[model samples]
Target: MPLNKTLSVLLLSLISGGALAAEAGTAFIALPGKAMLADAVRLAATVTAIDPATRTLTLQGDNGQARQVVAGPEVRNFAQIKVGDRVEVRLLESLSLELKKGGAGVRTRVDSVEAARAEDGSAPAGALARSTTVLADVIKVDAKTHSIELKGVSRKLKLKIDNPEQLKQIQVGDQIKGTYIDALGISVTPQPAK
Candidate 1:
């Protein structure tokens, strides 16, 4: 699937941000505010096999497990990777929510992407990162039930407010502005002279 589509699914699944918590190899950090969610995972795997023709690779993880992955068209420099090279994978995701007061009932979206590969052309390495932001209007706020509804990007979502006091402060016509980011980086390093 396209990155944008994958990101959309990820964002939708993450609408309930409380579930995005810490993992064994992942680090989760949030800002001082309660509305920010962030996490990162970094690992190093050995490239056990590679097939340039099929754009496929086999990676042996540190735990002695092997897994195969196929590179999609978005990976422009797949041919640069090599067996025995150490593949470092880093994944990161973050989401931040802010309340926009006295804003019009408008919905907006913004996105950005960045990527890079090994400059020498022979090293198997690449990185891709993307971010998305949405600004939506609050359509409903039910303090009795601590539920809120937001309309944005032509989609409506109903969410339960974690704090009843927070819900009481929010009002219809307010805005829920959210920023989400997802990034993946892969780098290959040649084996030392052995």
Candidate 2:
């Protein structure tokens, strides 16, 4: 997907009430189009602590508030999550006691999850690497201007060929990897790594 399109989808999700917020005061806020927070919630948090025996996790928010959450058997190993690692928790169901006007019923539904990185690292889209570089595959080659249109796994990129010699060596279906300085330009020379 293109970055802009992905961002648009995310924004639409947020605007349509697909996101939820939980505060330290034990209050949950729901966004617009989706179900209630207790209805359908999408929360992002960090793992502060974990108990493998109990299958529980102590998650903290960016604001420093913490909550005790339990994981199901589907979660293979709690050890995979480290302390301070950001995690996205989707509240699928809550069986808490609620006082309603008519009657009481257990709540069960599906929700979304969004996780953020704990610290900034030089990794391509969260991959493990010391130095990361953005890459794009050539989608279209303009022989006239010596420019190429490329698309990555997550974004569409356009690159200008300052060196005609290097551009002559490139062709359609070629993969290029380089440091992106701007939308249509590269800071470093691209090489065929893959």
Model number with the top lDDT = 1
Q: What is the TM-score of each candidate against the true structure?
A: 0.72, 0.27
Best by TM-score: 1
The Cα local distance difference test for each model comes to 0.68, 0.42
Please give the range of 10 consecutive residues that has the lowest summed lDDT in model 2: 180-189
Instruction: Indicate the TM-score of model 1.
Output: 0.72
lDDT of 2 by residue, 14-109 (tens): 324423243322234322211112233345556668787876667665556666655444333334555666554333322221112222122222
Off by over 4 Å in 2: 1-42, 90-194
Could you list the CA RMSD of all candidates, in the order they appear? 6.4, 24.0
Q: What is the lDDT of candidate 2?
A: 0.42
